[model samples]
Target: MVWIPGGTFEMGSDEFEDSKPVHSVTVNGFWMDEHEVTNAQFAEFVKATGYITDAEKPLKPEDYPDVDPEKLKPGSAVFTPPTHPVSLDNPMLWWEYAYGANWKHPLGATSTIEGKDNEPVVQVSYNDAQAYASWAGKRLPTEAEWEIAARQGKPATIYYWGDSLKPKGQWPANIFQGDFPWQNTAEDGFTGVAPVKSFPPNAYGLYDMEGNVWEWCADFYRPDSYTKNAEINPKGPSSSFDPEEPGAVKRVQRGGSFLCSDQYCIRYKAGSRGKGEVSSGGNNLGFRCVKDK
Candidate 1:
């Protein structure tokens, strides 16, 4: 395991109500994967462990009563643009929970990973990621560790690199450009996820910590928990909640995905955090590995 020497740094922010009172945090040394786990890597894990992703497993009737039995087959979420305007509050407006889509088939029923062996594996649930990490002898980074490394040794700035959204006219991160939802300039060289390590690494040699895809963390999300937390290695709230969802079973996801647009959701910022269903997976979600001494 490659060790990342730990030290003190400011965590969280005062921008959002949840991110109030930025405080110091001292992390102990822990090893972490330089980048997100990729398709090829996961393939090997599956070959060796015969591990089945959540999407591949059949859905129990009790678990998904509303889902059509036929649609319960292996699948993943694929971005589906609305033919007309949609409710921004409801993500299902633009996100289609397609059938026959998984890590192997990212774009619902037809897409395959034939040429994207190096790209970070998508459509992996928290359990799927944990399974892969366990097989690889690693673990997911705590949200604190993720935040510290994402800052890349710099003081907490809005963006990972600096305060400037577009420094010197360079699209440093892979984010949506132009009109968003309706139109993307692809000015960042990519309208969708670029392969892992496609962009320059941060000061700590970590890649894709900002844009590309939202990475999973071990912490249970607490939007307001940061307002009153300890200074050292705070582990977030005991649980999470999303009133929109049926039953609250959400987990923390950091580093906004390619779908993030300033005009829509300005969640691409370093401090901006969101939660995912604990057992969910989508085209714009992936996971990196971490280790503790």
Candidate 2:
């Protein structure tokens, strides 16, 4: 873990609608994990508690009565890029509900962690992450804490490193290097999840803080969260709300993922934000933990 000194800085971005109304935020010094939780770490937590992630639990028809029961089978969303370019408007083109896809089987039943123990554990729901944090005697970082750590006492720019995606023609993080969902040049030496510390650490000595995988934060999703604008360590909205998906309870996700590309999802930027259903986990979503000073 690394220590993040308390300070105030601008939060949110004007580039995205949800990250608008950039405002001032203050946070206190705290200890944070230097990288996303790895598969090996999560495996230990599960072994100790006999824990089962939400993705492994069967979905009840009553919870999703409108959907087909067959499609509601236990699964998590996986990114299977197409051979050719497809409609960017439809997320279904790349996201597939892969049955048996959990942290253990990231790609599906046919996949396994195998020798990738150092890779960040994906397909972990917010609850699963919370449970792991609890077992470790830590807690999920608030969105404010996450941003502060990611920024590393630097001025807000397009990314944690700087405004340029690839500064000095060098890839600072692991992000999709080609046309998203259809092409990947692997310019950063990875088409999928890379091992922890695969990229350079931020100014605060935090690794994989910009890309590689999206990280869960302890905050409910709300477009107008900035409006609340608590000056000292704002803890996010009291409840979740997303106008796009009103029925689903969502939590904030930060740092983006390897799937993020400038041509499509540019969420890897420092000031950008993302959200996911509390019960839903994806092959690109994971989390880290924090502790009090």
Listed in order, each prediction's TM-score against the native is 0.93, 0.98
Q: For model 2, how does the per-residue alpha-carbon lDDT over 121-205 read when each residue is reduced to its tens digit?
A: 9999999999999999999999999999999998778788998888999899989988878999999999999999988888889
Question: Candidate 2 — number of clashing residue pairs?
Answer: 0
Candidate 2's TM-score:
0.98
Candidate 2, run of 10 with poorest lDDT? 154-163
Residue runs of model 1 more than 4 Å from their true location after superposition:
1-3, 83-87
Best lDDT among the predictions, by candidate number = 2
Candidate 1 residue-wise lDDT at 32: 76
Each model's lDDT: 0.81, 0.93
At residue 153, give the lDDT of candidate 1: 73
Worst 10 residues of 1 by lDDT: 12-21
